[model samples]
Target: MSTTVWIILAGALVTYLTRIGGDLVLSRFERIHPRVEAALNAVPAAVLTTLVAPVATTGGVAEAASLVVAGVMYLRGGGLMTGFVAGAVVLVALRNLVG
Candidate 1:
């Protein structure tokens, strides 16, 4: 097989194993410990931060502006859906204005 095909197969194998391993590990714990449960709950915020931090810092004006707006909305007690909608609207308006 070609090197590219081998690489793709390896990646797919690794991805599949990752998903299966996560399920197995979680299933082994019948009752999660408090600290572990809290950490697991924080995973969403951590993932979101990882995903958005780069865009907020180095993205285009519209992206950065929208991230800031969304953050403000979230801090100001807006729910996730509200923050997302407000940020999307800001991004769309900025994109239209700039383009």
Candidate 2:
């Protein structure tokens, strides 16, 4: 097989194993510790926050401003979708204005 084909096969195998491994492990385990369960449940939120923190904190002027606007929208009872849309709009508008 070509290099690209090998790489694609490897990626597919990895993905399949990851999905199957989670199911197999969870099915085998009758009970998990409360702390472990809590940590597992919090993993998604922690990952998302980690991914967004840098963009929200250490970006250019436009990004920083948009982060602030998004944060305010979130604080004012706006949902995740609303905050994301507001931030995107702010970023795009500011980029255009600056350019």
Write one digit per residue (lDDT tens) for candidate 1, span 1-99. Answer: 999999999999999999799778989988999999899899888988898787678779899889889989989998999989999999999999995
Q: Estimate candidate 1's RMSD in Å.
A: 2.9
lDDT of 2 by residue, 40-63 (tens): 899899988999897677778899
Please list the residue runs of candidate 1 whose C-alpha ends up more than 4 Å from where it truly belongs after superposition.
71-89, 92-99
Flag clash pairs in model 1: none
Query: What are the lDDT scores of the predictions, listed in order?
Result: 0.90, 0.89
lDDT of 1: 0.90
